[model samples]
Target: MKLLFIGSRLYDDIDWYVKRKNIESILTESNENAINLDLPDQVFIVPRGMDGPKQVAVMQNVDAIVPLIGIDPPLIDVAHMKEEIEQEHGIPVIAANVRAVELTSNKIKTKKFYDEIGVVTPEYQILDSPDDLTLEFPVVLKQGEGQGGKDIKIAKSMDDVEEYFKNFNQALCEQFIEGSEISIEVLGFNGEFVALPPIYKGETTLEGTHPLSKVKTGPCMVQGLDNNLVQHTAYKVAKNLDSDGIFEMDFMYSPEKDQLYAIEVNTRPNGTRYLTTATCGVNSLCELVNMAIGEFSPANISDKLEYHYSTEIPVGDYNGPCPNEPVKSFDDNDFVVHGPEGYQRLTARADSKKDLDNLISKLL
Candidate 1:
């Protein structure tokens, strides 16, 4: 089987899996300097949008297309391309459709979607100005579109709201819920979706600290929250979207209120994949390759599930050894180190919590 994968930034993460599947890889990148350009069987330096990729997919006559875009801006374009390619031709393109991207790409739209779908989300009001704010202080001020905590502020006062408005005229103000921040990856393809184990991303702070800077653990042991509830809710949301590929959903469980609030949905590969792969033996990136090859299903995911205690921590600069293989799977090693210099993170796993602690100590 041949696959045309758009974007080379994340190719390295799944190159081993693609090669192992005996799938011929053709990649398109915006620049020649992108990483893992040489890993693909063939690479084409196309322009930055999905237009070039769609054209290349046809010209190459690839069997399928799997977009590896990690950012939000180009998802709409990719959705359009996916729609056209799959409709004009019979080739499968593993990605979210236009409606899914439209609903998820914007924070305000996502909140409305959650409400319409009967999924609980934080109370929100669109603020054209600071004077229009009614969500109360300690609310989360955010733009309609951003990721990784970008343009997000915990407003403690009117001054903070005014301070935030200097750059943007509008905001998606939401009531800040102080509780356990959780993330889950639900893989969907051909109308079947499977929500993996929940990951605990730590408690929220008044400073609006993102999970990126916090230590996170998998198979969430939060006392009042049940993993089944999380997985069921995530599955519902994915089915509502009715899209293919991966959906990385962010949620918060407030023990005080005994509520689980949906925060965001990213219909692509995300930061949560590393810990998800460690906790459960399923790798989302590798699964995308499987989706293109017609191998993704609920039964297949069930067959791959392996329970383990896993945790990811920010080391800033990891002076530790690397994995036995280039892949991120923990089959050969207890730990996998990722990220760039001065911002590296280590994800370690073990059979038990005690073993996990000991493995972490040894890795550190």
Candidate 2:
């Protein structure tokens, strides 16, 4: 089978799988200097948009297309392209459709969607001005579009809200829930959806800590929260979306209130993949390829599921023993070190908590 993958940033994560499947890999990158360009069978340096990749896919006669984009900006364009190409060329694009992107891309629309679906999300109000704020103090003030904690502020008072409004006129103001932060990856294709184990991100703090800066673990052991509830809520959201590919969602569970509130959804590859893979032994990126090849199914995913204790730590630099070639990617080793030099993370997994601790200590 031949595949056309857009964006080279995430190509390395699934390069081994692509090679193992003996798929002809054609990749397109907007930047000529992007990494992982040499791994694909054919590389095309195209302009920054879906148009270039779409042209290359048609010209090369690729059997399927999978976009490996991680950010939110390019998803709408990719969704548009997927609609046009899949309808006209009869080739599947393993990505979310236009309607799915439209709803999830905007935080306001996502809040409305959750309300419609009866999924509990934090109470929020769209603020045209700081004076119009109705949520209580210690609320999250952010724009409709951003990722990785960009343009986010925890407003504790009117001054903070006013300060936030100085730069942007409107904000999606959400009531802050002091609870354990969680993330789960839900994979869906051809009407089949499976929500993987939820990963425990750190607690919500008044100081507004981004989850990326905290140590995280899988099979979230939140005291009062149930894993099945998280999985069920995620599945409901994904089924409502009725889209293809990965849906990485963020949620907050308040112990005091005994509530699980949906935060956001990212319809692409994300930073949570490494930890999710370490925890469950199911790599979402590789599953995208499975979806492209007509091999993705709920039964196949269930067979591959393995329960393990996993944790990921953010270390500025890693100076540990390497496992093998592509040490950053998953292998038979107990630990996988990934990320750039200055911002690295180590993910370790084992059969038990004690074993997981030992593996992390030995590796770190």
Candidate 3:
């Protein structure tokens, strides 16, 4: 089967799988100098919208399309293109649908969606001005849209709120929950959804720490919160989304209050995939290819699941043992190092916790 993949930034992450499947790979990039342009069989340097990729997909007569966009801005256009192309041309687009993107792309709308689905999320109030604030201090001030903790602040006083308002007229203010932060990845195709193991992303701080800066481990071992509960809750959210491809959800579990609160969801490839794949042998990105090839199902995923203790640590640079060709993949190695030069992270796994500790100590 031939496939058209959008974006070259994340193409390297799954390039090994695409080549292994022997599917003709076509990639598109807006910038001519993007990194992974050479990995695909054919490369098209298209403009900055879905129109270019849509045109390329149709012209190439590809069987399916898989978007490797790892950011939030282009999802709506991809969703729009998915609707039009899938309906008219009968070619599947392996990504979230329009309704799912609309519900998840906005923070306020996501909170309301959680409420409608009976999932617990933090109490929030949309603020037009600092004077309208009702929640106590130390609240999370966020815009309606952002990722990687962008444009987010933890306010301790009215001054903080006022300072935040200078940039935007409105804010989606949420009561900050102090507890362990968890990230779970769920894959959905043909109405079958499976939540992979949850990753422990450290604790929330009064300073509003972003998960990207913290040390993380897979198959979370929180004291009071159960991993099954995290998985079940994630599965519920993905089912409600009623979309395809990957859904990465962030959640916070407060030991003080003994409560679990859903934070937000990213309906695309995310940063948590490496650790998730290390812990359980299921790769969400590879599963997107599976969906395109008509090989995605609960049975296929269940058979691929493997238990391993894994941890991801941020480092300055990597100078240790490396995996084969696609060094970032977990296919034949217990560890994979990724990210840009200065901010690289090494993710490794083992059969037991002690073994995992030994592996990380030796590697780092």
On lDDT, the stronger of 1 and 3 is 3
Q: Provide the TM-score for each candidate, comma-separated.
A: 0.98, 0.98, 0.98
Better of 2 and 3 by lDDT: 3
Predict model 1's lDDT versus the native.
0.91
Candidate 2 clash pair list:
none
Please report, in order, the local distance difference test score of every candidate based on alpha carbons: 0.91, 0.91, 0.93
Candidate 1 lDDT at 129 equals 96
Model 3, 1-364: lDDT tens digits are: 8999999988898999998889999998899989988889999999999999999999999999999999999999999999999998998999999999999999999999999999999999999999899998789999989888899999999999999999999999999899999999999988999999999999989987667678899889999998899999999999999999999999999999999999999999989899999999999999999999999998999999999999999887888876776687787888998899988988899999999989988887
In candidate 1, what are the lDDT values of residues 1-364, reduced to their tens digit? 9999999888888888888889999999999987888899999998888888888889989999999988999999999988998999878999999999999999999999999999999999999999998777689999999888899999999999999999999999999999999999999998899999999999999987767699999989898998899999999999999999999999999999999999999999988788999999999999998899888889999999999999999999987666788646666777888887888899988899999999888878
- Model 2: residue 219 alpha-carbon error in angstroms: 1.4
Per-residue alpha-carbon lDDT of candidate 2 for residues 1-364, written as tens digits (9 for 90 to 100): 9999999988988998899899999999999999999899999999888889999989998899999999999999999999999999988999999999999998999999999999999999999998898777889998888889999999899999989888999999999999999999999998889999999998889998777689999879999999999999999999999999999999999999999999999898878788899888899999999999988998998998988899999988988877775655566677888888899888888999999888888887
Relative to the true structure, candidate 1 reaches a TM of 0.98
Ranking by lDDT: 3, 2, 1
